[model samples]
Target chain A: MSRLQTRFAELKEQNRAALVTFVTGGDPNYDASLAILKGLPAAGADVIELGMPFTDPMADGPAIQLANIRALDNGQDLAKTLQMVRAFREGEQVTPLVLMGYFNPIHKYGVERFIAEAVASGVDGLIVVDLPPEHNVDLCDPAQAAGLDFIRLTTPTTDDKRLPKVLNGSSGFVYYVSVAGVTGAGAATLDHVEQAVTRLRRHTDLPLCIGFGIRTPEHAATIARLAEGVVVGSALIDQIANATSDAQAIDGVLSLCSALAEGVRGARA
Target chain B: MPANRAHGALLPSFHSPVENAMTSLRTGPDANGLFGSFGGQYVAETLMPLIHDLAAEYEKAKLDPEFEKELAYFQRDFVGRPSPLYFAERLTEMCGGAKIYFKREELNHTGAHKINNCIGQVLLAKRMGKKRIIAETGAGMHGVATATVAARFGMECVIYMGSTDIHRQNANVLRMKLMGATVIPVVAGTGTLKDAMNEALRDWVTNVDNTFYMIGTVAGPHPYPAMVRDFQAVIGKETRDQMLAQEGRLPDSLIACIGGGSNAIGLFHPFLDDKQIKIIGVEAAGHGIETGKHAASLNGGVPGVLHGNRTFLLQSDDGQIIDAHSISAGLDYPGIGPEHAWLHEVGRVEYTSVTDTEALEAFHICCRQEGIIPALETAHALAEVFKRAPNLPKDHLMVINLSGRGDKDMQTIVHHMEQQEQHA
Candidate 1:
């Protein structure tokens, strides 16, 4: 099994949802971002999503958009992002790490080179927001063939007709974008998320992760009861955006990850 | 598939025996929504089902006579279709090499070819039972056009314009507001066309239930590029009929400025199968290509995906999209439409660039010679006319898509004139 599958299986055995913590790679600066990544597993994060920053992150909201700009301004490129992954992997294992972002940076980095380096750099999965199943041959098929799990984001807008197509080649956990809006938009109702989870359960057996509009531990706890994993991106990245220094950025993200994890761990208690 | 040509040259004249032997360039973007490897539905999965529904609806509307009748009604009576293809007597005399004709898209309602697409999209929105209309604009022509159609159709309209563009194009902002559109200024990413487009996409993703995103140009995912091209093709169709009636033959060449390439594609698509007419798309070179400050994607860019399609984009080596600069807000986009990228790659269209300086000169000349104030975006195409017209044979007829009027561009032009006077 892939690292993602292994992690989720362990989480299932524990009867708790995985706390999927996300932060942009090299945000604010390289050292601080690497510090946050290295501390995530210790901070109780079950899965880590490192954002590969691109200038035009159209799918992101203000919080994550600012995160991408900060990462890029601090001279973070694909090469540095991969290097950060390698460094994080030197100290960390078992916790599945997924690189999430748009497709252009990967395209420019050369897809083959990106997949090869990602696999070698201890990257386990990808969550490309702009790459729908329609163009799966471009990246998804190739990456999956190379043993890298290709996660698909199934939104509220994806009806029953489209759900199977989205889940067909999907590995890792299936991401349920709880809202029809961009990242960091208003949270969906628990009722809406519940219905979506039930519908997604009918489609595929892949573990389902819920993201978008998830912020505080209370919200994470609420979603943890319904899905296999809970994703919090902008909420954690906001910690970096609000930090006075690199040390605070690392502390802010790790501490929040611990708190969110605590909420997810005790949700079923 | 047509046999690939070595250069950006047409196959042959339409009557040639080779014409039937080869495939048509018009048939493109196979089932996967690709024009070669350029165009595709690269949007988020949230928008995919909607895009597919739109494509299906568009295909149905293309076949339905009722839809055709309604579209024709709006085109003829509302948006003023069949904008004249007038022979530019002064421009032809000034060039002293070719007979130049102006495809006067500026005379359409809302004063640009943008209304052509807006009318078609608004009608589609109504057909889809959408209650709200949203769009992204750069110079505000498209915003104003979208606003106008939305008001006419009695729908709630919202337009996203870049903060920088809103400041530069204040007149268009007011015009959009006067038409009842809520003009939201996007303050992200240098606050330009691409940023506004990003915001608009966000809006569409959020309001996918009852909203229609009437894209202003021939860009975006799948059906958008092809649909916008079909709506704008009225320009080429009219020019074909007008030129044949007036000059007794098809024009030898066609030229238009390309930002997202709506106007250019509209004018070029009908002629793509002609196989003899030369097609040229002029991109805005804000400074120059060498300075790395231009928006000439084909000239100074590589193939990459953005705004839901893979196209030629001005991006850094790290794949960060470099901000594109142009005096004309309409042309200040880092990427070209995916179809244009395909055309450039397949050698069906020659793409070039016109610096801000050259476009300004052409703007002045067109105003002085034709007594017509041309949009700064249109001026880029005019600049190319000045370059190529003077070298072609006297009987070599040329059609330039006068894509918009200069009314919204007066501020930019005045600012440039002031700068020139100060430097002098």
Candidate 2:
């Protein structure tokens, strides 16, 4: 089994949802971002998503957009992002790490070379926001072939008719974008999410991770009860955005991760 | 002849739905909305089903006689279609080599070729039962055009423009407001066209239920490039008939400016299968292509995906999109349309560049000699005309797409004149 499968299976055994934490690689600077990445698993994060910053992150809201800009302004690039992943792997290996961003950088990096480097660097999965199943031949199939899990984001708009197609080649887990909007937008109603979760359960057996507009321990706890995993991205990036010093940025992210992970751990109690 | 008055108007060929044969180079985006690997439905999964629905609706609307009839009615009565193909007599005489004709898209309802796409999209929005329309604009010409069509169809309109563009294009801002559109100024990423598009996409994703994102250019995801091209192809269709009627044959060459390449594609698509006819697309070289301060994507950039499709983009070695610079806001985008990319790759259209200085000179010449104040974007094409027309044979007929009027560009032109006077 892949690292994602292993981690999720472990989580299922524990009868609790995984707390997936995301942060842009090299945000504010390389050392600070690396510190946050290394501290995540120890701080109770079950899965980590490292953002490969690009200039244009179309689907991101204000918080993540600023995060991308901060990361890029500090000289973050694809090679450096992979190096960050490798650095994180040197200290730890059990927590499944996924690299997420737009597709242009990977296209420029050469898909085959990126997959090879990612696999070699211990990166476990990918969550490209702009790549739907229609262009799966471009990256998903190839990445999965190389042992990197290709995670698909199924949104409110991914109707029942299209859910099968979206989940067909999907591995690792399915990210349920609770809203039809961009990242960091308002959260979906619990009723809406409950219905969507039930509807999606009919489509595939893959673990479903709910993301978008998820912040605070209570909200994550609420979602944790209904899904296999809970994703927190913008709220944590907002901590980095609001931090005045590098140390404060690292501390802010890890503390929040601990609190959210505590909420997910005690949700079923 | 009155320059703005279109004469010898005939029913445009688009009124009839003709199934394009497979052999024609005009047929593209086979089912999947790809222009030979350049265009595809690369948006998020949230938009895939909607895009598929749009593609299906567009296909049905094309074959339905009622859609065609209504589109033709508005084209004639509302958009004032069949914009004249005017002979640029003094420009031809000055060139002293080729006969030059202007496909007067500038005289269209919103004073640019943008309305041609806006009309068709607004109609589609209405058919889709959408109550609101959203679009992104650079120089605000497209905003005004979209606003006009939304008002005509009685729908709520919102336009996303860069804050920098809003400051430069205050006149067009007022025009959009007058038409009841809410112009939202985007302040991200140098506050330019690409930034505005990002904001618009966010808006579309959020309001997908009742909102129709009417992309202004030929650049976005699948079906958009092909659909916008079909609507704007009236220019090329009219040019073909007008050229044959006036000059007894098709023009030997065609020239047009390209921002997202709607007007250029509109003028070039019908003539794509005409093997003998030459086509040239001019991109804006802000300072110059060498200065790394230009929007000449094909000449100064590489192939990458941005704004929902794979195309030639001005991006860094790290694949981060480099901000494009052009005096004309419309041409300041970092990427070209996917069809233009495919055409450039296949060697079907010769893509070139014009410096800001060269375009300004052409703008002034067209104003003085032809009494036509061409948009800075259109002047890029006129500049290319001045370069190639003088060297061709006397009987070598050339048609340049006058894509827009310069009424909205007086402020930028005045600023340039002031700087020149200070230097003097």
Candidate 3:
């Protein structure tokens, strides 16, 4: 089984929600980002989402957009990002790591080579924002053949007719974008998410992880109870944004990650 | 299957030998929205449903006689349709090669071909019960057109423009405001046309309901390229009729500047199967292609996905869209229309570039010789005309689509004029 399957199975047995943490591959610089990646599992991240920095992140809001700018300004690229993942794998084995970003860079990097290198470098899954089910034959089919999970996003606007096409070749987990707005904007309402999750449950057996607006630990904990997993991204990147130096960025991100870890862990207990 | 939508699906990929070429080649985009592997709706999923809805509405409206009649009335009374086709005697003599004619789209009310598309789209927006109309513009021509239509129909209007465009084309910006539009200035990613488009799309996703995004150019998801082309084909249709009446024959060639390629495609689509009439498209080369600061996508760019379509664009190695430079604000965008990308590939039209200096010379020459000051965007096409005309025989008739007037270009022209004075 893939690492995502194994990790999700373990989380199922544990009878608690998974805490998925997201950060850019190299937010401020290489060494500090690597240090944070190595420590994410211990800080309570069941799945680590490493963002491949892109220039035109149209779907993302202001905070994560700034994080992408910071990573690129620090000279991050696909090679260095893969190196960071490979280095993180050296110390840990069980936790799943997914790479997320737009599709153009992968298209520019050459798709077959990117999938091969991503698999070799220990990437367990992918979530390309702009690619839809109609165009899934471009990357999803190939990545699945390479034994990597391809996560698909469902929005609040996804009706019954469109949900099946979205869930057709999806694996690992289904991401429920709780808001119609861009990433990192604000939290989603509980009633809307509850109804959405119930509707999605009738369609697929895959684990549903809700993202897009969950920022604080309390918000994450509340969202954790409603779904199989909760994703925290912009709020953690906000830690890096407020830091004075690379050291502070690394410490600030992990420290907040630990606090969010506690919030999600304590929810069921 | 609906009439227009289903017919669009059944279109043949290319022209057949026996078919009258005057009938358009709508075989493009297929069901997957691929115009011979160039155009597709590659936008964020948030906007997908809205785009599909608009396309369906447009399809229905295309077949509705009432909608066609309403649009025709608007075009005739509001936009001044059938803008004159005039012989340019001085220009033809000066070029010394081909007999020159001008489509005179500049004489249209509000002074460009942009109002033609806006009137068609806004009428559809009303039929679909959309209360708000939003658009993005680089030169502010399309913005003013959208605002004018919105005021006419009593719908709320908003326009997104880049900060640099707002500064240079302030006259049109004020004109848009006077027509009851809220002008939002975008200050992201080089603060130009591409940036303004990005900001407008951002607003669209956030306010999906009650809002209709009227893309100014031919480059977008399917139906837009085909729909906009159909609306503007009035230029080519009038030219055909006028030439038949006046000169007793079709012109040998046609020329138009391409910024997202609306005006050029508008003039070229009706004549696609003519087989003998030559077609040319001129792109702005801001500094020069070699200097790496031009908006000449066919000359200097590669195929990539941007602004909801896979088209030719100026981009970095990592697929990040690079800022395009042009003396004309309207042409300072990274990508050309997807249909233009396919047309370039098929060699149906010859694509070339005119440097900023070359277009400036043509602008002055048009003023001195023809007593007409063309927009810097149109000046690029005039420059190409001057180059090719001098080499052809004098009897070879060539018609150019003078896409817009020069009133909005005064700031850029004045700045260049003062710089020349300082240098002298």
**Best TM-score goes to which candidate?**
1
Q: Per the 3 Å backbone cut-off, how many clashing residue pairs does candidate 3 have?
A: 1
Query: Per-prediction TM-score, please?
Result: 0.98, 0.97, 0.95
lDDT of 3 by residue, B1-424 (tens): 0211222233334466555333345456577777777888777777777777888999899899999899889888888888889999999998899999999999988888999899999988898889999999999999989999999999999999999999999999999999999999988767788888877887787777788889888987777887788888888999999988989999999999998999999898878766577889999999999999999998888888777777888988867677899999989988999888877776667888999999999999998999998999999999999999999998898999999999999999999999999999
Ranking under TM-score, best-scoring first?
A: 1, 2, 3
DockQ value for model 3: 0.59
- Which of 1 and 3 is ahead in TM-score? 1
TM score of chain A per candidate:
0.99, 0.99, 0.98
**TM-score of model 3 vs. true structure:** 0.95
| Candidate 2 residue-wise lDDT, B267-318, digit = tens | 9999987767888999999999999999998888898999889999999989
Candidate 1 chain A, run of 10 with poorest lDDT: A87-96
Give model 1's TM-score for chain A to 2 decimal places: 0.99
lDDT of each: 0.92, 0.92, 0.86
Candidate 1: tens digits of C-alpha lDDT, residues A92-202:
888899999999999999999999999999999999999998889999999999999999999999999888889999999899999999899899999999999999999
The reply for model 2, stretches above 4 Å from the true place, is: B1-22
lDDT of 3: 0.86
Query: Least lDDT summed over 10 consecutive residues: which range in candidate 2 chain B?
Result: B1-10
List ranges where model 1 is wrong by over 4 Å.
B1-22
TM-score of chain B of each: 0.96, 0.95, 0.95
